[model samples]
Target: MKKNQFDTKLIHEGYKTSEYHGSLTPPLFHTSTYTFPTAQHGEQSFAGERDDFIYSRLGNPTVQILEERMAALEEGEVALAFGSGMAAVSATIFSLISTGDHILCSKGIYGCTYGFLEMLENKFGIEHNFCEMDTEEEIQNLIQENTKVIFIETPINPTMKVIDIEMVVEVAKKNNITVVVDNTFCSPYLQKPLTQGCDIVLHSATKYISGHGDVVAGIVVCKAKELADRMIPIRKDIGAIMSPFDAWLLLRGLKTLAVRMDRQCENAKKVVSFLQSHPMVKEVFYPGDFKSQNYFIASKQMKKGGGVFAFTIDGTKKDTQEFINHLEMIKIAVSLGDTETLVQHPATMTHAVVPKELREKMGITDNMLRMSVGLEAWEDIVADLQQALIKSNSNTVC
Candidate 1:
């Protein structure tokens, strides 16, 4: 297959035509081990002298195809898949950092990622600093000689803050630090972090890449062969390898990512406009909002505004719950990047483990809500929002 463009790459870049002329979709190879042609061949495979699969933990044909496709989409040299999003996250971080190393991360990270960093701090004696401010000077000052990784999530978790990936890479490169970007919200279809100078880019493939909420998976794409080599041991030893069946599912999902995201981005923009005009909304944090402070960064880095938005409502946690409960079509859920719309109160749900004071300080208040816009018609979604807002207003009246 010619490695043409992203959309073409999505369908054909990964796997070659099977010699057997099998089904169009890659079939599930549910074998534990491959039979060796001879004793010397087995010895060579086990010794890492030849490129051959030794165990299921090491690799599978289906997983390899997904990895290749992901690597192409992400524009990375190689990609690794994990059983779950956190598995990929943990394996990547663990592969990079040691006991005495330091990490500089964004303040408004995904809840579980924040927890992972906290655990490492307590148990591993590693050092870290959370920087809410993404100004180049602020981040540069925070970096120490021991800083091994500069971790960030663009259009950050629930808040939708955009970090300048180029600026981050420039700063990290000065001190020879690794730049690990979680490109979950903006899938490879919308943004390619590795091409923007990030050392590694990982995603919760269960999200946009899968397009459906049926599977839970994660993948990491790295620019350097060395980083890919480093992660291989951690992936195998940690035992978080993605299942062959899930890999096949992910491959199928990748085929239509471009189309799904196109509609998703459009719907998200309409939703943002509606929220911005609503009387109940206090603040709207969509990258498409040109007046936003993060707009400049978003314009520089992302091709689209992405499919997620976070806005503030004029109410408490109870009030927010009322609004969510009143919604007709949008599901009140925790996980994001699905076919159906999802809305949730980040402070109380996603970021609940975060310290109260810190959460409040970061603008993750009880009044805030995060929405993952789906493929639903814009008018229907807006109508649902209208009804929910009515309920929210009525609750205030009482």
Candidate 2:
């Protein structure tokens, strides 16, 4: 119809107030375990004959509601929640491949995700390769017999590079490789990777999905029930399941996701425009910007220029840090998707775990700064950033 289905699904999906004594809000089921009516009932649950929850580690009512809601929002067959974004990443990888398998990834990814990939190679025989994924030839050339997963982050972290999801999926389908997309930056509101023929879509629910600084959570949505069935045991055994309260909080966050993301994306465009025109900004990496290399692909994939962007200052690392220090309003922090705008130096902060040479290959330079725009007024954000740039100018000789 009008395409307002998503906004409505965010608030009302997977929740029936009548199921909870007519309470307007979904009641939080905060308990460690569930009691079975009898030994026979417990046996039925343990044997998978009943849908009753046996323990919180395995499942919970509140968490189940969140999972159901997220599945609907992301257009996936099923969804699972995790304690942290890394937990979701680790579990999904562990579930999908064997010890000797290989993974192909986007050149730029979250610093922690990079770390986890390294760990996989070191501890296990599982290896990975990085590709720009710019063309079908490039993707086909990189595929190996052992490559089991094609993991990518579109509008990739720090660099804001947007890969064509359908292009990757098309090549992946030919080889029977699982396509896993990290949708943390876009959230389901902007892009639905599963609908583009991906196998799994993931998110650091701590960011845009939660839309606040308070919660740390993750979600994994699988297009096929068979794929989700494979990951559930991993989540349970790893013991990284999301807490009941976190699920409750996320449900609250999802209710406002459409509004919060709309505001943040709008503010980000205005801020990026100012920075692009500013003298101190040498380069800007925003998916929505017409000048960006990724602009066309992003326009084809994403609904908006997401809330995050990156840029390089026309100065030294010292000058860059000085600019961040001089900001009076925008906070110098690594996390994003909060009500307050946040910024961080990728080379020294979030992506520091990645080796300097490798980080450079990913275009994460010392003078580069990544910002997550918030729900603040566009004028105020631009004004604060302008003042900081002015203060940083004095730190350099020019």
On TM-score, the leading prediction is 2
Worst 10 residues of 1 by lDDT: 14-23
Best by lDDT: 2
RMSD for each model, in Å, please?
Answer: 1.3, 1.5
Writing each residue's lDDT as its tens digit, candidate 2 over 1-398 gives 23349999998888888899998888899899999989999999999999889999999999999999999999999999999999999899998999789999999999999999998899987899999999999999999999999999998998999999999999999999999999999999999999899999999999988988999999999999999999999988889999999999999999999899999999999999999999999999999988888999999989998999999998889888999999999999988899999999999999999999999999999999999999989999999999888877876656
What range of 10 consecutive residues in model 2 has the weakest lDDT sum? 1-10
Q: What global local distance difference test value does model 1 have?
A: 0.90
lDDT of each: 0.90, 0.93
Writing each residue's lDDT as its tens digit, candidate 1 over 1-398 gives 35779999989877767643766778788888899999999999988899998888899989999999899888889999999989989999998998899999987898889899999999988878988657789989999988999999988888898988998899899889999999999999888899899999999988998989989999999998899899999988889999999998999899999999999999999989998999888999988679999889898889989899999888777887888899988999988878899998898899999999988767788889999999989899999999989987987898
Clashing pairs in 2: none
Q: Roughly what TM-score does model 1 have, to 2 decimal places?
A: 0.97
